[model samples]
Target: MFHPDRPGPTRTNLAIRTDPDQPSDTDPPSDPDRPSDPDPPSVVMRTDPDRPNEDLIKYGWPEDIWFHVDKLSSAHVYLRLPKGKSIEDIPPEVLVDCAQLVKNNSIQGCKMNNINVVYTPWANLKKTGDMDVGQIGFFRQKEVKVVAVEKKVNEVVNRLEKTKVERFPDLAAEKESRDREERNEKKAQLQDQKKKEKEEQRMRKEMEELKSYTALMKGENMTTNEVRTQNINQYILINN
Candidate 1:
């Protein structure tokens, strides 16, 4: 039943499996003599190999982009998208970041002059027949071309690019901190307003008392001695 002319299943939306035995760009070489790498870029440490796809399903929407190096070995890379955002809505910076990741994670990618990264929505990535655990297929047939040097240049430009994963929880935390600070400032303003009101009331009360004493002293029924005694007693009371 072996017909050579039929061609094996037409390989549509096909992907190559990254053999576990083979070392990847993601990990450092086993040789102790070599200097150890200071960064881990491709590794998504929060998720295990058993369900690396979970991050895609959980945080990434179906509309989110998935990329692989064309005709070369590459790590499965997904650019996360918000639930309602479409591929068109993806920012240019994110696209640039994903392109760098795809190029860097490919086998001998840095050595190559240039590499083309084909990407598609997760929805377009299908598992029609029985594929390996990490292997998947893409139907969208879209590609973003990148020069290998660009990845190196970007990494050099921003050192944080090494560990920069898709999720940016730090940005969210900073925004939350700003909001809390603003709320605290508003509360402090309210306290200041209350204090000002109290001070105003105290000043008005002193002014009214001074007016009453002046009116009593100005009355014609009081003699000069009586006025003097009244003024001394009023001054003492005010001081007290």
Candidate 2:
């Protein structure tokens, strides 16, 4: 059971743990390429092997990163990244935590050494009706990343275990609601942009008309005040 209370629009009925502690002595050295986050507030999610949940596949958000033991039946672990973050932005320590959790959940993987863990963004997950329950494929195989897990890190597992809580959220409804909100937001943004463009066009037309009136009122163009007034009236009439 994994659960952590993090306020958000979408929630799922999967076991969730949040914000694992930093790596301890048992963990492997951090990757030099990946940056470390000092204050990571991300959520780790996993499905029960005994009771597979397909909703995870169906309702996964774009921000989700999926993890599993390579060529082995293991729990489907997911890392829900924060807004504005991508799969590449996942910290090295967090990657270790997820890989360790997935490895430990596997009956065979837990005992193996130097085995690889495959992960990819949730958007790349491919589901077909022909596939069995709780099974998924990838749209772009190249997008999947592999992480080598030499052994299980008990310290990281223990830290993540402390945050476990069981909660059954309505994954479908949440996804639908989130999708609706996003559509509405995009629609609003488009409307705002159109409104702004129309205002800009109106302003430009006004400025052009004012420039024309100023040109007409110039000493060389205007012989008298009456002529200037006449030109202004004629300009307004033409525009109207």
Candidate 3:
């Protein structure tokens, strides 16, 4: 029931799963069988376990949280968080879902018990030209987190698999487009801010000029003709 259309892109045969029941800080849990809402949280993975997609590592968005089996070969799983949500904000159920998906896709992980899964924000992922395809290092090891999966949960895996959808996306193009849009949006915001400040400054200057003009035109500030005549008469009397 979940569609594969979204902004971020990955390589060919990317598996995406939408969870309608994904809980948020503001919303309650929904029925899993119900259709997914627009822009629902999703989990992404590679369909081919043997071949890891380099585009996924290279072009992943900042919102993506990467997941893999610790010290084992597993499909690279990513959780595409909603806007304003961080990796720490991931709900417990959703975390388990991602962990299970990674475990399920891994040949050795699926057969083992008490496996460990490591995850971190995509921004922490560090890739080098010397590294082999899909190989990645972390910029900060402290940002990485580990979760223990005691055993595979068939219900969760089944639910996710049922909603899995595949799509081929141009990763490079999508990333470039997203970056360009962000830059343009920031530029527009800065322009608007500058315009607003200029307008405010203009109003302040007009207010100051009006105040000065009013002070200059005040009766106390200008000598009247009658006062001038009185002053001359007083001067003549004093001279006489």
Candidate 4:
């Protein structure tokens, strides 16, 4: 059943499908305008469709070289190197692969240009989600010139894409939701504790007043039974 402001199972019915065997470079309905690459290279780019503005650049040690289209674009590509390979030893095949991967993901009519390659250590790569809410807050966007690649980052991205999708909302989203729910629960718990404390304090004050009244009656000529009768009558009057 449908309810106002609340979405139904219709939203869940929407599915995102990707072919495991098909390379991410398979153009989205090939544009007749794109020039054919005689020998394509390998490169990596983002697999998500929501955010068109984020990019991940691999830097430092090249164990995890990630590359992507620079701009408000969705292209995440990674270069896998032999365990000890340095960035300087990256082959022409790798460069071509990177270029083809970028060209395939971009707008069909994008002209060829020298794309920027950040030669920093792989440790410098920022793993922020392409769909993250505040990714634009921390990083400045720069014009990235795509370095020509000898291979495509499409295959690596395709393999990891499945795992990423199966894990819903990504890690950041899940953590944020859990933290918020926990905070709300904690606040409610504290309020209950405070209420119980107030009730206890009120009970103690009433008991102390009764003790004082009994001490005063002990000093008077009145008997204990007479004092008890007077206290019961006072209580009834106050309650009524």
User: Using Cα atoms with residue i matched to residue i, what is each candidate's TM-score against the true structure?
Assistant: 0.40, 0.76, 0.79, 0.32
TM-score of 2: 0.76
lDDT of 2 by residue, 1-240 (tens): 111122122333345444434443433444344344665745677877444567887888888899988887777888988767888888788888889988988767888999999999999988787766666789999999999999888877876665565567787887898789889999999999999999999999999999988887795554687788999999999999
Position 45, candidate 2: lDDT: 77
Error of 2 at 53 (Å): 1.3
Q: Which one is best on TM-score?
A: 3
Residue range 1-240, candidate 4, lDDT tens digits:
001121111111101112222234433343233343433223333333233322222121235354544442423344545455755555664455444544444442134354443322345444454524213221222422236433345553343333222212232454466567778999999999999999999999999999999899776756767889999999999999
Q: Rate the local accuracy (lDDT) of all candidates.
A: 0.49, 0.75, 0.76, 0.42
Q: Rank the candidates by TM-score, best first.
A: 3, 2, 1, 4
Off by over 4 Å in 4: 1-46, 49-62, 107-120, 127-240
**lDDT value for candidate 2?**
0.75
By lDDT, the better pick of 2 and 4 is 2
Error of 2 at 237 (Å): 41
Cα lDDT of model 1 by residue, 1-240, tens digit: 001111222111211111112244543233333233332122221211222333342233444466666666555566555445766765554555555655665555645755666666767776544554445565544533332333444542242233333332332354467567778998999999999999999999999999998998777456787889999999999999
What count of clashes does model 2 give? 3
Cα RMSD of predicted structure 1: 15.2
Q: Which structure is stronger by lDDT: 1 or 4?
A: 1
Clash pairs (backbone) in predicted model 3: none
Residue 7, candidate 2: C-alpha displacement in angstroms: 32
